[model samples]
Target chain A: MLKYNFSAGPCVLPQEVFKKAADAVLDFNDLSILEISHRSKDFVQVMEQAQSLAFEHLGLQDKGYKALFLGGGASMQFLMCAYNLLENKAAYLNTGTWSAKAIKEAKMFGEVIEVASSKDSNYNHIPKSYSVPSDVDYFHFQTNNTIFGTQLQETPSVEVPIVCDMSSDIFSRQRDFDKYDLIYAGAQKNMGPAGATLVVVKEEILGKVSRSIPSMLDYKVHISKDSMFNTPPVFPIYVSMLTMQWLKDNGGISWIEELNNKKAGLIYNEIDRNPLFEGFVTDKADRSKMNATFVLKDEAHKDAFDQLWKDAGINGLNGHRSVGGYRASMYNALSVEAVETLVSVMQELERKG
Target chain B: MLKYNFSAGPCVLPQEVFKKAADAVLDFNDLSILEISHRSKDFVQVMEQAQSLAFEHLGLQDKGYKALFLGGGASMQFLMCAYNLLENKAAYLNTGTWSAKAIKEAKMFGEVIEVASSKDSNYNHIPKSYSVPSDVDYFHFQTNNTIFGTQLQETPSVEVPIVCDMSSDIFSRQRDFDKYDLIYAGAQKNMGPAGATLVVVKEEILGKVSRSIPSMLDYKVHISKDSMFNTPPVFPIYVSMLTMQWLKDNGGISWIEELNNKKAGLIYNEIDRNPLFEGFVTDKADRSKMNATFVLKDEAHKDAFDQLWKDAGINGLNGHRSVGGYRASMYNALSVEAVETLVSVMQELERKG
Candidate 1:
């Protein structure tokens, strides 16, 4: 059975990348990627090349950024960024679940000022305005809210260093790289796999925390080792590099963004036109180009609609358990053809009704 | 080519597991594994089954211990264990690089006492005697030294809680589970992949530390969430579960130990009897059954001998750069057939000389 995947993360990846990764899993150039020592020249080259490609993709050459592939997910970075950069206090604008997780981790490290929150409205929209503390070490935000299907259309311009968790939306759009002092994303979403977390940091903001940090958790130690301080998640990073290469070969982020816009537009149009369904978020401007969320207008039809989608060979369209509805995650790798098929299914259901 | 992998960690897995993982990567039960949510009942079942199987394989039923698959590897546990358990001081047995890493992590949390050292012999032998401080929280040691090619024949019987980094030799032997209060291992060597770390800790020993530990780094937090406090390395854990299932089906760790001993004996015998090579570690009792270290008798012939092995489709046999010699890491998944092939290669080299 050929199924189209629309899960928020650990989402779809290019079939070519999967084939390459599977081949390497058994035998990587006759030396399994796992078997090769991290310090070995062959594996070092793999690390260096992965970082180089990431920087190239992000266009971060003289931006004073260090690219590191570390374990733990983007959730860890919320604490890591706070532990490494937050000295006295930090400010966070909570948009969704990921931002909340980040803010919680930040509070453990230092005094965290919740500048603004969308939770009052059940996080149906991104916060409009927030104050950035001049004394605060950094300001943090999530670019896209996976659960609520909302995105901050513009990067928050703050006086302090701005850190972002772009886990679901990174590399899907083109933006000025200089806007963020640090950015991190788990590879499972738009990148590669779940094992590695890709972090790009401004080197100067580190080494200020008074707290004793574990060597593995410390971004500085990873930077010093070139992200090979310990044996890295070799297979994940290698596949990520290949994914980046694929992204590059396919005309980079701008191309992906254009394609993503088309996919999101196709699905959103169907939801808006269909009488039985209505978008959950209710705000058009805040609608995410990555994850499109909708609910049945007649609540009784929800389960039947879900089954209809499942019967149509669509998987992972069910919304997060917390946000009980349907969510179609249109990540960069999700093909336009898949979106077309989903839209057609919705239309056919409407015609039959 | 049928390449034999002898890398200490990120080592070989059963070919069956690899094929299964590969099949899932492309399409897992008709949906790619990456496409599924971790919160899904299917993935949750995977975690439950893996943990249940791991405990069963170790014969750890109703032992007042919890099995957790975590991130940051065993290195993270060094700090986590110390932060959670150490109040005043902890004792450490210095065996090799891994032990040194553990000692370094422990120092950040509290006073760490080095009870014994084999550094005098370049850590080629595990220390025979160590003073355990009854006042300390726990005693720490590495069971098998991967780089130095040595193993502790028997872990020291200590009154305080024992925490061992059994990263390399885990699942290679059967052991009395009662010996240690906590045991942690990175799943790269014998268990599975490079991303997940396996932790087995007594439940009663937690929540005793004064320091405020980060939620993600705290073992208690993981235990509370059933190791799902954060998004886990799901794919790696799944692969680990498959490997655990494989081990269980093959008669568990006791059966694995017999096969391990048989493989180690064959290669060690060949090294001892061959005039063309010599074992690097001096003591007979200290040799590791997992990683065997040897040097060519004639220094000039090292390159030629290495090339000979490489040409024979044997890979990752090079020793750590810190110790310039050859190391054939016969991890648990490595077959006796592979070790017999290695012994034949050594014999052939001797005959050529």
Candidate 2:
């Protein structure tokens, strides 16, 4: 079936990037990238180029910050960050599923102080008034709650280092990168494919924890090896490089932010204006620009609406199993045209009602 | 330029698999697999089918054995196995660099007892003496040493549970699958690609360790979730399934084993017969059937021979920098014609000498 993808993650990638990646799979510089040794100069060049592009495009000039592409995804980083930084009690603001997972991983390594939680409201809104402990090592939060369709407009002002899991909202908007002591994201969502995770860490903050961290799990090991501590997810890093290059070519983060905002605006406006559909997330200000969650007024209409979208070749529009509604994730690579098509469907549904 | 790949691994795969994989990069089932949601039925089906095919082809009827595809490659399994099995000291048979690494990871979790080591022989041979302590939790070994091109012709008889890192020789030949309690291989070598690792383990052996293992690093958690503990390396697993299916379709392990034997025999015969070249491993019985390591008789001819192979479109023929000269990895997917081509080149070098 001919389909337009709006999946939350392992999400859509630019056609151009896909074409280039496909070409490289067969013959990466006349040798299959798959067959190329990770230690070889050719692959080293690939690694360096990708890393350079990522740092360059992000406009990160801080020498203290090291950008690493490592294994085990962002969920792995929750523990890694905690293991590396959380020696004493660490504070976390639980907003949604990912934050809860991060908190769970943190508690495994050290004393985790959940400063605030929106769980009482079913995580429909970002928690306010984080009570950071004076002895806490760092405060952690997910910048965008992927499952709940909520986002922290600005990182919580805290006395300690600010760690953020920017898995869903990374590079979607402009922010002072230096404010975050650490930021990490799984590449499957907005970056590239599923294997690699991007970790940006402040170098000075490491080596504080008194725990014997595994070399593979240690961010310092990756920082020293430049993320070549072991054979990395080479193809994902390569595809991510191409995507970042595409982002730069199309006028960097500023351009992407504008495009993303326009796309999000179109869909949010439609959801607000339509009577048949209701936005699930209570707070409009806290609503994610990446994933927009909504539900039809009549629950019966959900199945029919889903079929309509599926028949129209819209894929991955179903919300997470936990959320139980519709979530159209308009990630960076998702076209504005796709959002427009979805808006048209919503309009058609409203007219029919 | 047409290139022949002989890298120890991230080695060559079937050209057909590469072509099909490349096609899938842009569109899988008319929808880009990259864009497919992990929760979607289509991808779930992919995961189920892959697992089913792997179990079917491995002829694994023992419900106690669970097959899992995970991230972090074989190196991760070193820690995972120790975390799952080790209560006190574990026994290790150090065969090569990889075995040493496994030993190191094991030590971090518990006291690792060196049962045997062949490092005195420059890891040119697999150690024959293996004294698995009755008190030790598990005995570990690398099935095939990629660097030195030596393989264990038979499993070492040990009372303790056996854990093998079969990264380079998993499906190259058929063996009695019931011998080992656990076996794992990084996919880049003999399987499909670099992003995933295949782990086959017995269920009864887990939960014996006393240490608080990280959930991501826990085998029990993964086994409980059927390896869907997190969003997996979906594409890599899918491609691996296709490769496994290909193996099954082409008359299963017996046929592939016969072909692998032929390919290795042709290359080994040429190495032994060619006056200009000498096999590096010294012991004839210790020679690997997968990676055939050799060097030019005259050091002056080394560069010339390398260039000759490169010009003849042979790639990844260079041995690891740690152990330099040449390594022609005859993986299962490598065509017999490629081996014949390599043999012919060896003959031409001998004639030149």
Candidate 3:
């Protein structure tokens, strides 16, 4: 059943990407993907390509930027960032769970000064007008909140080096890639699968701290070794490199952003127009292009709406546990047609009323 | 050509396992394996089944043991153990590179007491007669040294809990699983690939430490979340599960261990008998059943040995950069026939000389 999958993470990859990835698994250059050593020249090329494409797609070439592929998720990055970068204090702008988690990790290393937060408003919007203190080590923020369906489309100017977690929205839009001192994204959304975490860092920002960073958590160590200090998640990184290739072949960031914007526009329009449905995030400007959350105006329509989508061969529409509604995550791999199919299901539910 | 792989890690997998894993990537239960939501019942089942099978295979059931599949390699685990388990001074028997790495990480969390070390002998053999300190939090050792090709054939009787980094040898042999408080393995070695790390911990041992472990490093948090604390290395975890199932279907560890012994014996005998080669580890008792290291009697034969292995369609035979000789890592998936092929190459090299 050729179902359109809307899984928020470990999510949908392009059909073509899947085809090649599968082929690689069986025989990647005559060595089964599982058989190839991470240290092999062929696999090292995969690592190099993954890193280079990451920087190139983000337009981060030769700007003192180095991209690294590592395992664990953004969750590990939360602590790793602090372990290597934090000195006396660091400032954070917390918008959602991931941002809050990052803030928690920073506290373990040094004093964490939270500049702003959106928790009081249920994280429906990205906190704006947050002050970045000059005295802090670095200013950290999540560019997008996956669960709350909001995004900071623009990187805020900070006196201290800017560190951003772009886990959910990395390749979905165009941005001034050089502004941030460090930017990291878990490869589950818009990039590749869930295993490899991508870190694009301005190299000069590292090794400023006095703490002895563990080899695994040290950004300097990973960058020095080209992310080969240990056996990397080869298959995931290989898949990510293939995904980056797909992104390149599909006309890079500007082309992808246009498609994503179109998909988000279609779904949001349906939610606002359909009398039976209402958008979860209150502000129209705050609605996420990646994860579009909406709920039925009447709980009575839930069953019919679910069944219609199920029949339409749709999957992973359930909202997060904290937010009980439907979330249609439109990553780079999701097509405008898939978004249209979801909108049609909503319209059908409204007509049934 | 169907070549045999002998890379230390991110190493070879069974051909049948490769075939199935490839098929799953394209379509798992009619859904793309890469596309499925981890929260979906299907993937949840995969996670649950993987954890349970790990405990079952280790004969750890009803032994207060919980299994976790986490991202990051054993290198990450080298820190994670200290974060959760190291409260005060911990005892360690440093055998080789991995054990030394683990010692380095443990020093970050608390005081570390080195019980013994084999570094004086360049890590060629495991140090014997190391005393376990009762005053320390726990006693730790590596079950197998991948680079040095040394194995601790018998578990030491420790007064404190035993923690083992079995990254290079897990599932290759039967062990007294209940004796250890914790056992960790990077899946790349004998299990699956280069991402998911397998951790089996005694539940009762946690919460005894006073330190606050970071969420990602917190075994309790991961155990509570069923190792889905983050997105997890889904592809790696899924592959490990498939490999575990393959292990069970192929008559489990006991059957695997017998074959491993045979392969090791064949290769080690060839190295000993061939006048051109000499075994690296003097003590047969200390030689790893999985990774067998050997060197030429003279370095002049290096080019010929390299070409002979290449012509025989073998891969990853070159030893680690630290110890430049040759290492044949016969993980569970590596066949005795492959080992025989390597041995035949050794014999041919001797004849040519």
Write candidate 2's Cα lDDT for A151-181 as tens digits: 8887566778989899888878887777889
- What TM-score does chain A of model 2 get? 0.97
**Tens digits of lDDT, candidate 2, B91-195:** 998989989988888888789999788888788877775678888888888889999999888877778898989989888787776888898988887777887
**Top model number, lDDT:** 3
Superposed model 1: Cα runs more than 4 Å off: A31-34, A40-42
Off by over 4 Å in 2: none
Docking class of 3: medium
Which lDDT tens digits does candidate 1 get at residues A21-105? Answer: 7777667666555455666677778788889888988888778999999878887787788878877899999888888888888
Q: What i-RMS does every model get?
A: 1.9, 1.4, 1.2
Better of 1 and 2 by lDDT: 1
Leading candidate by DockQ: 3
Q: Once model 3 is optimally superposed onto the true structure by TM-score, how far is the C-alpha of residue B75 displaced, in angstroms?
A: 0.7
TM-score of chain B of 2: 0.97
All candidates in order of TM-score, best leading: 3, 2, 1
lDDT per residue (tens digit) for residues B1-353 in model 3: 55788878888888888888899889998787887878878899999989888987899988888899998999988898888888988999999988888999999989999888889888888888768779898888899998989999998997898888989899889989899999999999878888889999999989889987778889999989878888988888888999999999989998898999899889988887889988888678999988888888899999999999999989888787777799998888988889989988988888898
Error of 3 at A151 (Å): 1.3
